[model samples]
Target: MLIVCHPVLYSAVVILRMVDRKLSEIAYSIRESFHDSGYTEIFPPAFLKSDKVDGFRFIYRNKIFVLEPDITLRLMNRHITENSKIYYISQQSDEYLNESLKAGSEIMGGDEDETNIEILRMAIKILDNLGIKNYNIDISLTGIFDSYVRKKDGQHLIRAVKSRNYPQIQDMEIDDKDKLLQIMDTRTRKSGIDKLDSIIERIDDPRIIIDLGTVRQPEYYNGLIFEIYGKQEFLGGGGNYIMKNLRGCGFSLDLQALSKLYHGSHERVEK
Candidate 1:
């Protein structure tokens, strides 16, 4: 009778039950959001061909998950029509592998909000729904779009990471606008930026301030760039990059660190 009572079986059953419950809750929330927003739930393949992404370590095996050859290829290969708005929901494995030889999976999804600003705004909305406020947000806008719209307004191509807790975000106290100007002019004339500059400078807009500064990830950034800070420390950053002639910007939220700033009570994990 004692042999029949296996500890591993009990523990595994409990874990599976907990996981199933969590998945149910997550699915319910997602379904509710999609139903309210007129979005249909979508499913993407768990395994894909790995591609060269900055800071990503992709593994190739008998099974290869790689980046699609081209954006056109992705669109062409998709089963759905192009005009359809997609709401992909799936467990995605990150290129980052753990010691257990398993890739970290996250409940990842994105809505095509169109512009970078709109995307950031949507992200903020999601955070707000979680009762998260008083956090810094990072946004990245492409220079092409920024140069066009920024002529009317100075804001463009900015990456903002939002966090409720103020990290070491300190203003460098850069009083000299001329210094910023010089950096801009010099960098604009450089190889890749020079081309982007020509397209941007063609438009005559006095409101636009073309400032120059280096971001943390150089390989990822091409044209315009910006970041947000809290308490003078960089909580998050991102930049615009032109790939396949499509300009896009993105940012990441440091949730682990941000949790420290939450005013709400914390619940301990059950062992």
Candidate 2:
């Protein structure tokens, strides 16, 4: 029998096991939260048809197969029943992406604003359970920048804005780059519906900040968009989108990255 006695390798394996256990604990707690909210977990097909998403592809029997880089497309089809609230935690594969788990949910058959509010609230609840206090959810209306951006060159402007690179934006052919810059400077604003603000206001959570600037790709998102962050890392992001003409919104959590929040203390993680 070959002997295997590498102490360094053994320690690395132990560390991986510890982190894995903590990640499971976090996922379980968050799953219960979803269940309490009437969302049943689902396992989506490993591959699906949609030209909207980019992922690794292979040909089998002359048919094209690909993995989803973004889980948002899983609900792109309007097969979801009205009044069905669903969540899924499954492996997601994409071009250039290795090892990722996404926990997401979609609320169908509800009022549009209500869906936005519910999904945003649930996103907060998930992050809360994970003990990520130094975080905020930046909310923005999709297509708010439509008037200023040309359909042909909007993606480039969006990338510059997303990176907060003002110089790059100014160099673009756009006549009014300042208009886009102003959106990036925002911290908060009131939507016509005070009720949505009412829910978030009382939580006394400092993590919520409204962003009026983030560019929403009309093809991807149509209404309210939100992203969750811990310090500077993007833990999750989702928003309202029209898929197959069906209006809906949802969020997806990065389960693997969430383990970094535990900081190696199992006792605190168990808490």
Candidate 3:
């Protein structure tokens, strides 16, 4: 069949391409902002040693297409300065696709990095022109492993389809230190309190405070951390991880989700 002569199919293809172009433009703008902010972009390998990916709160092995033993772009970075700001933008796997409506489709997806870093660099500039900004937003990440999971037929299953999968943490506006503490306790025990103190002792920085009250529920958050809540939920947050030979803090903005919650109805934004 001559592909170009089919009007209906051609129109569908045209619409999909147009939508993809618009989405790509938006993704590019997000990346460019990172460069303007003095971030030296690093390409980390997506694939890793099998053991490293294990016990992660996100994607698991059985769900992915395993073409190679090594993970793609397996990556990490170091700050040139004490607080050297670095920026990275690339397609990240939504490991929890198995739990969503799109589960039946081939779950493996990619984000834009282009075939070359030079192309990615140019794309970032285009995105900067498109008006993406520092947004205080509420966002939800899907397929996030909830600690309070269930075992049915000897296998763990997510408790609810979309129920609090990942806390719309960016949306939570926490004010009182005491209230944050209560939230921590309500979720889990004094898991961070003792270990946090030890991590503080090693640092001895007057600027850092080991507050049990400011905890975000992650099993690996074993040291210093921080976040800002803008009247509804955590806007942006990150913490230190020494065990992985990594030590850094980064902020994530959910502009699309923010637009939904405040300007309209909350929608899922890819992180």
Candidate 4:
């Protein structure tokens, strides 16, 4: 007897395999890049006993366990000395139980400007290594938004700005509403734009963008924040944060999204 296979199913399987292979290749490139930069790879446990963690929680043998949500937080929990450069390729689950594959590196303790430039360079190199040419890094300072986020109606204001709801933002009773609106609309500000300019000058990358309205994870990031984009599709983001009284800066790339983007671009090119 002979078996019959559907053409669509077979095609889907082949595409998935190609994506898997691409993902592996990208991950290897990321690890190699970090390794050459003198970053030591560290592995953190998947499950934590702390209920305070903002991650997927489950009951295991009548005990509560939380999946590792953020690799940086987990690493901060361990003893790390000043100037510790580390990297990890890990699976992280958020509060909604959505799992994502991430390749990231963290630099603990260094001159702010030097460390930031180093991280940015590494991120750019990873993209270059993967042959992702059409990409940009949107940079912002988290502190610039601190005042607005601390307001009583801060959350609503943030939502409005993120969505570019001009009327809604104007109606809100907030100081510097005009500035906020301008930044949201233009994605640039004169106040903190100089920091971004300095970084760009040092890196000399035309793909770096000064975006003042990037407000994601405002509470988590206390300093320079950046998001990587592959032709408008979000790859991942990172910034400076203080954890366990230690200052650290890092960035993570979404391996799955990257694989899709890379393969999709190549497929289109082939066509």
Q: Top lDDT: which candidate number?
A: 4
lDDT of each: 0.36, 0.73, 0.34, 0.81
List the candidate 3 regions with Cα displacement exceeding 4 Å. 1-4, 52-83, 94-135, 138-218, 222-240, 243-246, 252-271
lDDT of prediction 4: 0.81
Query: Each model's TM-score, in the order given?
Result: 0.41, 0.87, 0.41, 0.87
Report the Cα RMSD per candidate. 12.1, 2.8, 13.4, 2.9
Q: Residue 271 of candidate 1: its Cα lDDT?
A: 12
* Candidate 4 to native Cα RMSD, angstroms: 2.9
Residue range 1-271, candidate 3, lDDT tens digits: 6645589888999977755554454445555655564556654344443433422233365553311111111323222334344454333343442210000000011211111122223322322254333322111221222332223311112222222323442233323424433433332222354543443444333323333334333434433344433345333344433323433333333333322223211121423
Q: How much does candidate 2 score in TM-score?
A: 0.87
What residue runs in model 4 are displaced by over 4 Å at the alpha carbon? Answer: 1-8, 61-63, 163-173, 186-194, 264-271
Off by over 4 Å in 1: 1-23, 50-84, 99-114, 142-271
What TM-score would you give candidate 4 relative to the actual structure?
0.87
Give the clashing residue pairs of candidate 4, or none: none
Judge candidate 4 at residue 63 and give its lDDT: 81
**Worst 10 contiguous positions by lDDT, candidate 3:** 100-109
Over 1-271, each residue of candidate 1 has an lDDT whose tens digit, in order, gives 4557589999999977755554444344434544555545454443345444322244766644543222212222345532333343333223353111111011112223333333334334433443445454322223333332233222312221112111212232223434433433333322345533432344322212233433334344554444434444343344444434444443333333333333232222221
lDDT of 3: 0.34
The order by descending lDDT is 4, 2, 1, 3
